[model samples]
Target: MTSTFLGMPTTAPRGVGHLRGDQSFPAAARRALADSQLRRNLGHATATIRAKSAAVIAEAPDWQQLRDAGAAIKADVMARLPELLEQLEAAVTAAGGTVHWAADAVEANRIVTELVAATGSDRVIKVKSMATQEIGLNEALEAAGITPVETDLAELIVQLGDDRPSHILVPAIHRNRAEIREIFLREMPGVDPALTDDPVALAAAARRYLRQTFLHTPVAVSGANFAVAETGTLVVVESEGNGRMCLTLPETLITVMGVEKVVPTWRDLEVFLQLLPRASTGERMNPYTSMWTGVSPGDGPQQVHLVLLDNGRSAVLADEVGRQALHCIRCSACLNVCPVYERTGGHAYGSVYPGPIGAVLSPQLTGVEENASLPYASSLCGACYDACPVKINIPELLVHLRAAHVTAQRRPTTESIAMAAAAYTMDHPALYAAAQRAARLTRLAGRRGRGLPPPLSGWTIGRDLPQPPPQTFREWWAER
Candidate 1:
């Protein structure tokens, strides 16, 4: 099921989104865990979201059936992605809209920048869009001397603070009220000086700041929750009305969406609309759900452009076991219940996509070697699988990606050598007995409940190694 772009294999695309540094997840997690404030913020936010999701999900008696349907629909979309995307492009064009295919993040950004430049506007308002973030579109726009304004409240907070989003549904979940207030005061040009940390006040201040941009911005960019292949309709679901304003107020509207976001038909939207709100914001229905079929006369944006972004998605779909990661609907339920994500937060994952989904998705999309450590970021508790509305087996994918990482290594690592040695020793009964005897002798030299020497010492830093028993299990068996 290898996906191809322009006749080239897409398993590993160049210049797709990835972490900036060589630092691995363990290093990042260590630093993040040390931040008490971050831990508190993540803990509180995830706890609240988890509780709300649980409550609403309980109200839906057929939630599992809905989940199954969502998974099936996504699977169908992935299976026929190439065909559906063609259908979608034709539909959008027939409806007087243009569609562009971007094989990677670099191409997507270039297309978007060029499109904005064509409009002769140096600024564009943006609805909260993970696709844009994944491509670093705001930075790209700024590099080209264009300003990109974020209109969503949480996205606005993250943008103003010059921080990366730590959660999917709530981008600024890492920032508390007081932190948000400080960012608003320091960064916002015309914010009230006497602003407080009250949620309503924060909302009002953000609204006041974004109102002018929403009213006057000539262009808007967005990401789709789902794109219906049958009607060429792009859907954006949000709690705030900002997405609506962005979709309608602008004369030229551009949407950047992952190719995986497409569904086969309008009927498929029903399952996702029901699944998304509950799994994400814990609401029965989103406060606003906007859908537009290409260009509309005198109603919304006259010029509609859609950039169907691959950016390693086709590569992700290439994997049989890991392809299920594409079924994700950007619901952050996996984050809410994930023990590792709650403790270390999203920055540790070092991608736009975070939490348990990120753990599997990032590595597979970018090549497991690039994000090798991400596969090991989870505790394999399977909470993510349980929480996912689309039932992506995130834990299984994590392990599969890890094996991919190991298989791709050109040289044998220390862990690999150790594993190989242990395998050989266990294969021979005499050698196994000798190894056990040797381990017991080493136990006599080392103190009980003490850290082991180098390599092994790293594992025992936080806990002591247990002393080996005097008699080997083989010796006990012989006595019996």
Candidate 2:
């Protein structure tokens, strides 16, 4: 028997990875909006992170310069991505690490599964990895009769609950203390019967459970935050020590990273290290910063392998305007400050990468026609752009992607016809004034603060339309 989501395969497809629900943004958002608990969880979590990020960012006087340097470094990386990736591959290989190139998700999963099989271990420990999630690696591993344990505390909570991540920095942000306590007691092995919802108790319980797995697991999988092309060093910036443990404890380590994660030099890495921590966790520096350059003789993992994934990234890089999105370091600052995301949450976007960044990236990765509503998910308030550390102009990109969606429509839509009609009317003064007179006659049939009918009703559902003025502004001006 195979599990599925909305009749589509649960695992990611061959080329571009698919969104979870397969439902459009509007449809999923309607469902998300009804979950009052989710709304409260997102609102509280986002507010706290937003405040923390702002305070720490204010402390750095050269923060803007750092942001500029980060953006410039990323831009240069993109410009020379092919060359840098080759350099990275050679460097990793020279450092005694094997490099594998996966053109798509299926290939990446196959390569990773085969590698784990060769190790003769059916169990592997994982560091927190968005790349693995994006490719649906856990499901793939499970199909091959291997168990991948999530070592990160939030990831462990999400795994135990059988839930998808709702936030970037905090995957289980949707679950409160009480909910987490229930998940731990129910799913975790050897959990105390009297476990409470207290934070310290939950941490202790999780630590004990994961400690056993960490010691036993012979294989570990991870994702890189940034891979330095110049030195072949892979960096994982984390708040918890789980990443460090996973990177060092296992005999074999396999890291799956997106192609866009590579930077040109170690100096370029310095700018991002400063930008990422403050933007993500609001700390001047992350608690654990793990770096490994391939294999070490008697130290960390003896067998190290890196899979470079290009699932929809090359396509995204081809677009001039859209490629700016690749500049994202995944700090998720935009998610913390978005008004729509606060209310609707990450699941509404239907992709692993959600919030404002998802709105732009998803549509471009999967054609705008497929995820048309995602681009319109925002209020265009420009909050995302303001909060972005790399200065991605998200609002401008949203409009651009929306235009692409309109262009892809096979036939003209009702909204398009209406907009065209209004444009034509406004262009001709005689027609505009005559239309205003016609609208004024509706004052007799219409009542103040009443809902409109049909096409206009949808707008009025949330807000009432004002009655048309008795006389036009032009008419009043002429009388004066």
Candidate 3:
């Protein structure tokens, strides 16, 4: 974890879009915690997901082994990413697919916008894509006068409400069925006024709304779950069949994938196919697992393009310890199990990615300075590590990012000064004893029920300061 990225830019480039939040994590979390409805919605949804995940996970005799294999494959991919990417590009080109490389969000958006423009299609159907969200593709397309219709059920909810996604897998997890019913009533065109909050009714309503768009949309945009270098294939796994429609019905398919999504072979891809579904949706397998290798003649999309997005990932990979954050398959098991995330919700983290993985990954992607508060968002309970299908050591990554943040500080803060003072006093026996005696005076403040003053008050605000004992261990030992 101590290893550094030599001759690499540790900081992400300015203006990485949705990666940076408007406010700090603490500030945002404070507001989110006060929202009773948000807490209730998140708590219920996460609890249900956790129960299902655990139930299915227990059915596997070799679940831990699967996790290990997934982790090892990711490690191998990271190590050989450059070579595999080149091989993938060559294979894809051979299969009649074009490849474009994007270094950051701005370039990525421009690439996609221009590609969409070239097709003479003013509207495109979309699968649920984190990469597209990270780059703000919908907004970009809108700006270019192209309408991007989100086909995923959850994504459709988010788009209709004009709300940012709060969860990775379930984008609208914060919305209860009642809230979703309202969104549809308000936003959906030609919707029935009597739609109830039932899941089946809601899904049917959404399906009806998207059916015409799916059949007519000439272009589609997507994100890959895994991309195979050996066969030039891209995979997308989803519970709903919306992704299947987007992949098949469109004349042109443009997939925006993070560089980390590339696997060395279809064999390596096999490990994650097993791991992702069970960990993510708590299902034995995804209902719709769609894959495409370039273009097929008179079958599916006639034109295929894959945009390999770097967007600070090169800097992330250069860091030895922080790079494992790339191993995430977006299962979101960590979010469901995270106590902090359960209460504060995904909006608090200020990224498309929320919860434990987001806490570590967002800051690293945008640089420690941009999202510094995120590293401290975790309680280090290690639940996220246990829940991760890829076995990403998220707790360990949090600590590493924290140390990186502290070391990058240009000036000493009050906490740093206080810690330094405490260290100096502890190094000397006489001074330590004197400090202990002095600390006893805090019992007076304790009796008054008033917390510490100024900068120290920050600590006391969230926690109780224990009153000093009447005598020290040394003093008691001497008396005995």
lDDT of each: 0.89, 0.87, 0.91
Candidate 3's C-alpha runs over 4 A off are: 1-11, 444-450, 467-470
User: How many clashes in each candidate?
Assistant: 0, 0, 0
- Judging by TM-score against the true structure, name the best candidate: 3
Clashing pairs in 3: none
Q: Report per-prediction Cα RMSD to one decimal.
A: 2.8, 4.7, 3.3
lDDT of residue 46 for candidate 1: 90
Pick by lDDT: 1 or 3, better one: 3
Model 1 pairs whose backbones collide: none
Candidate number with greatest lDDT: 3
Question: Tens digit of lDDT per residue, candidate 3, span 219-295?
Answer: 99999999999999889998889999989998999999999999988888668888888899998888989888898
lDDT of candidate 3 at residue 422, scale 0 to 100: 94
RMSD of 1: 2.8
Q: Which TM-score value belongs to model 1?
A: 0.94
Per-candidate TM vs. native? Answer: 0.94, 0.93, 0.96
Q: Which ten residues in a row have the lowest lDDT in candidate 2?
A: 6-15
